[model samples]
Each structure stands twice: as structure tokens, then as C-alpha cells.
Target: MTAAVVTGLGVTAPNGLGTEEFWKATLAGESGLGPVTRFDAAQYPSRIAGEVTGYAAEEHIPSRLMPQTDHMTRLALTAADWALADAGIDTGELPEYGIGVVTSASGGAVEFGQRELQNLWSKGKEYVSAYQSFAWFYAVNTGQISIRHKLRGPSGVLLTEQAGGIDAIGHARRHIRKGFPAVIAGGVDAAICPWGWVPQIASGLMSTVDDPARAYLPFAAEASGYVPGEGGAILLLEDAESAAGRGAEHIYGEIAGYAAT
Candidate 1:
């Protein structure tokens, strides 16, 4: 039987830019939750969030592609790049059609959508860019990542909210079982903008507590709600046999089993 194993991991989280930083913070029980800064959250019920900081998009992405991509897409792209590097599998040496991308995105690109809408209303339709059409779509990450990497295999996007990331990996495992060499699967989300906040606020699930430490107590009875966060993770899923053949190091545990109803 074929098997899928995690060879590399890349992360862009509110706490850290890459896996190393994120792991250190996580191990120390440090919280990334803080007062929102991307925009003024003064009026919102939930004024705090786990926003990614110190990320320089230009450092990870080419300037030509920057303007066309939204923040979430940038996170996804960067994470994927890091994941590929960590795996030691160079795309330049791989078969294009053998590599695949499967990702999950819940909010799409709220900031981009919001800005485009504002342009449409204030500056007329002519002000909007052509990329606006798909920049904010939920499936944009998978499409963009696939194109950037020249991956022509079984690519797809999952939309199961928080569960989507895990679902993406499961799907990739199935794809590998069916004969694809490998798949990049993960999730990225950056929906803290005005438009995004409004919908989240409407859900009534966000924490309104002003105190960052006491704001999100999910396990306690005093748990009012949870703080919102933005970021994503990317993982390289290669079959066990192929990974061993290529001398890939499995630092993380292999996917022993997967099931979804």
C-alpha cells in the first residue's frame, strides 16, 4: 500500500514568520494574540487578533506578482516556497505534472475585495484592476501556487473552514495513493479587514474582551469567545517509498492514518 509522509513544513503564523520561530514561541507557551494593528479595531467588539507581523512580502515574492496577489495569497506563496526548500526537492529538477497543490482558504481575500468594492463605489469601475476578478476568490491560492510552481498534477482547493487544511492533506494522501508523486497541501487565511470583520462579528463568536490574556478562554466556562487570527501553513506530502529513494528526511511523523465523514 502507498503511504504519505510529511517531509517538510512551512508556516506563517501570527506568532512567527517561519516554523522555527513559531515552534519556539509555541513551546514557551507564548501568545501571539495582541491588539489589532493592521487596521483600527477600536470600534469592533473584538479589538484583538493574532495578526502576522514582520512579514516582508517583497522578500518572499517577486515584485511583478506582488500587486496581483492579496495578503493571504502572499502568505500561502511564501509558506509553499519555504516548504519546498525544506523538503530539499527542487521543482527545477522534478517533473512538472508529477507535483500537485491542494490548499484550503476560508475567507479568500477580504481586504482586496473590500478595496475593490471601495474603488467601484468611489472611483468608478475603471479604477479596479483585472486581477480583482479572482484575487479574492476562495480557490485563488491553489491556482496561484500551482501556476507559480508549474505543478500540473491533481490540484484542488478545500473549503471546510478551519477543517479545510487537514482535509487538504487527506485529499493529497489519496492523490498520492492513486499515483501522483507528491502534493503540497495546507491552508492560509487573512481576513481581518473591514469587510471580513463584519461577517465575523455577525457570527457572534469572536471575543469582545479587551484584555488580551483573558480574551480567549475556550476551555473555561468564562470563555465568551475567541480572538481572530490570520496566517497559514504549508506541508510537503510525499509517498514513503519516493521519499526514501530521494533520501528525504522525515523529521515529522508520517501520516499513519486518515479518515473523514
Candidate 2:
């Protein structure tokens, strides 16, 4: 039997941008929820949300990619980069076909799609950028990460909403069992913009409480609903034998088993 183990982790959450920062803040009982600031949510029923702060895309992403990706995809790419670095894997020396990417997304790229459509309606069809053809796709994150890292093994994306991230990891574990050495798997999502908010609001599952602290009491009887947030995590899943062969310094844990209905 083959074992899939977690070698590295990267996190981009509203509370923090990296794994260390997020962990420290979480242990300190800090929260990132607040009134929406990406746009004016003044007229919306639910105004507060978990928004990633202190991230300037220019600092993390190449200037050439700036015009080709959405905010969510950029975050995904950054997470994947961090995960690989954390694992101490020098992708340049590894076999391209030995690595793969599997990620999940729910909202796709609402902000990018909305902007393109607005351009189409207000200006002309030609005003829309060619990148829109894939920027709004749910699989864009997986594709972009794979391309950026030069990973050429099996790749895919899942869309099970909140469950998608875990599902992606499960799938990646299967890939590892099937002989692949390493796989980048996880999920990152962003849909806090006006266009994205409309559908979420229509779902009737968002908490309407104005107070950031009280808006997301999921386990309490006072729980109205859940608060919408952006960002997530990415992980490096490697076959146990391969990890040992590569002199991996740490093993977070093994994906010993998985089951879902």
C-alpha cells in the first residue's frame, strides 16, 4: 500500500497571509472579519466579510502575469509557490512529469468576469481582454499554478463549494498512490465583489449581523447564518517513499485514509 503524506502547507487567509502568521494570530484569538472594503456594500443585506489584507499583487506576482490573472488566481499561485518553498523542493531539478496540481474553486473569477462584461456592454466586444476566455474558469487556478511551476503531470480542479478543497486533497492522494511523486493540492476562493456578493446574498445563507464578532456564530443557537470570506490554503502532498528519497526534512502527517459519499 502507498502512503500520501503532507510535506508542506501554505495559507492565505483574512487573518494572515502566511502559515506562521495565521497560526500565531489564531492562537491569539484574533479575527479578520470586518465591514466589506473591496467595494461599497452599503446597500447589501450583508455588509461584513473576511477580506485578505496587506497583500499587494505587484510584490508577489510577475508584472507580465498581472494582466492575465484574477485576484483569486494570483493568491492561488502565491500559495502554491509558498508551499513548494516550505517543502524545500527545488522544482527546477525535479522531473516535470513527476509533479501535478489539483485544486478546487467555487466562485471562479467573478470580479474579472464582471469587469470584462462591463467593458463589453459599455464599450465594445473588442474592449474585452482575451484573458477573459479562461480567467473566469473554475480550473484556472489549477492550470495557472501548474504552468507557473512547470508541473506537467496529471492536473484537475473540483467544484464542490466548501468541500472542494478537501476533495481535491483526496484526489491528489489517489494520484500519489498511482505512482506520482508529488502533487500540489488545495483550494483558494474569492468572491467578495458586488457581482459575486449578489449570488451569495441570494443563497440566503449569509449572516446579516453588522457586528463582525457576532456575524458568524455557526455553532451557537444565536447563529443567524455564516459570513462569507475569501482566501484558503494549498498543500504539498508527496508519496512517503519519494519524500524519504528526497531527504524531506519534515512530514506533517499522512493521508492515511479518505472516504466520502
On lDDT, the leading prediction is 2
Candidate number with greatest TM-score = 2
Regions of model 1 farther than 4 Å from truth: none
lDDT of 2 by residue, 147-220 (tens): 89899999999999889999999999999999999999999999999999999899999999999999999899
Error of 1 at 46 (Å): 1.2
Q: Give per-residue CA lDDT, model 1, range 1-261, as digits (tens).
A: 898889889999998889999999999998889998988988888898889999999999999998889999999999999998899987666676888999998889888989999999999999998899999998999999999989998999989887889999999999999987789999999998889998889999888998889998999999988788899799999988888888885547677778888
TM-score, candidate 1, is: 0.97
Ten residues in a row with the worst lDDT in model 1? 249-258
Cα deviation at 8, candidate 2, in Å, is 1.2
RMSD value for candidate 2 = 0.9
Backbone clash numbers for all candidates listed: 0, 0
Q: What lDDT does the true structure give each of the candidates?
A: 0.90, 0.93
